[model samples]
Target: MAPDPPDDPYVLHARLLAADEAAFREVYEAYVPLVLGVATRVIRDRTAAEDVAQEVLSHLWERPLSYDPARGPLRAWLLVLAHHRAVDWVRREEKRRGLAAPHEAPRGDETADAATDGLVALRVRAVAAGLPDTLREPLLLAYYGGRTYRQVAAELGIPEGTAKTRLRTALRVMAAALAAEGITP
Candidate 1:
């Protein structure tokens, strides 16, 4: 039997469910340039973008069930996937570059430290209460519970970069509020 023509994206998508070789080839050939473009725009490096594009396409090939034609067209879905992969790559690179500082807890003078810690806790609570839940939750998990950023992301069901960004925003808001009160963390 002759294999079906690979012109229609919907047909190709359906064929992917069976791990069809022709459909996979058609998808890669049709979308590689577009996916590479989106990844490069976000990553700002052609070589790394090519890696991202390859990973995204390979993910589609390996986990074809992850895609939903009902959500949107395959092209748009590929673009979104490529973009997310690119953003993740950029975030990883930023961390590798030490662009963000890690937060550390303070310690000293046990008796005096307890008293000052109580006051600081109250002030932190006041500032945190003013933040939106989306920003506040990850911050609390990472700081109060002493969770790693990745743990916070997993606990909150958010992307790791989003968790990091929200935590940064929350800290900034708290810092501004503390500054207005003539205090610094």
Candidate 2:
């Protein structure tokens, strides 16, 4: 289980946006495991998962205002980002692997693919339902739908800072909820 961030998520997020490295470190330490878990689940490669997790965190640092509290919680937003990056990595790998099999039939592993997709969808839905609507929708857009934070803000008609605050609040709520469920976020 990851330790909770030292300050409330909103305060931590504000600090992070202001270039507070220590606050950013707290966010990184608290959520890296959850992000790595999602990445590993998709990529099935430890090294690649680590790389992707770093990339996700880096993205957060570069675009701290993308997280919106009104749209959903922060954990979900980060997980969604992790998941999308992992999926993108997997897809790129598939493409690379496919290039070596130009003469082979398309990898028609339909059943397995369908099952995996179904399971991911179900889990995402369950997690989203567990979140308040304010945190759920924006996180979903950024994470699951692969929209950028700017895009999410545009769609929600809110300023980017507000979006980030919503995202942080959402993450705090999720962390608490996961704790209650005997799970760590």
Candidate 3:
């Protein structure tokens, strides 16, 4: 039979909670591939995905208490962290490329205009990322997913009124996030 996998994640987490370096290393080794895979799937850039994977692993080591077993399994938590980080990276990259939305190109010197556009786009994406899933799901479905609000409600299994509420709330939250990011939106 194949050798048994490493110790239980809870056991490993317990060791981690105790500030055991060895335990952190063990967890890192156990999950790095899975974490990297998740990050790459979302970021679609090997270098950025590696960076996000490292960030996720480092966060786990630095903040062991952040992982509460009650919420879910350790693996799931790690994957979630990886996914979020990857999304952040993708947003940042989108901002960098000024590809968050389409608009007329800046009229100034091309390089300077591109830089300004990038910053604005980045802020937009960062704020969008702050939106809660309740609102985000419907908004993404309606906007990026190219679905109508009705379709979004159907897909999310929420009443259309609830979906509309969520979409409005999400937009409000995104606007606030943008303001916080120092952009007028």
Winning model by TM-score: 2
State the lDDT of candidate 1 residue by residue for 31-89, as single tens digits.
Answer: 88878877777777899999999998898899887775543456655665676567668
Tens-digit per-residue lDDT, 49-142, candidate 2: 9999999899889988776544445666677677667766876777787753444433323543454455445444565677877788788888
| lDDT measured at residue 34 in model 1 versus the true structure, 0 to 100 | 75
Better of 1 and 2 by lDDT: 1
Which is superior by TM-score, 1 or 3? 3
**Ranking of models by TM-score:** 2, 3, 1
Question: Among these predicted structures, which one has the highest lDDT?
Answer: 1
Each prediction's RMSD to truth? 18.9, 13.1, 11.5
- When summed lDDT is taken over every stretch of 10 residues in candidate 1, the lowest stretch is 104-113
Q: What clash count goes with each model?
A: 0, 21, 0
Question: Ranking under lDDT, best-scoring first?
Answer: 1, 2, 3
Cα lDDT of candidate 1 equals 0.72
For lDDT, candidate 1 versus 3, the one ahead is 1
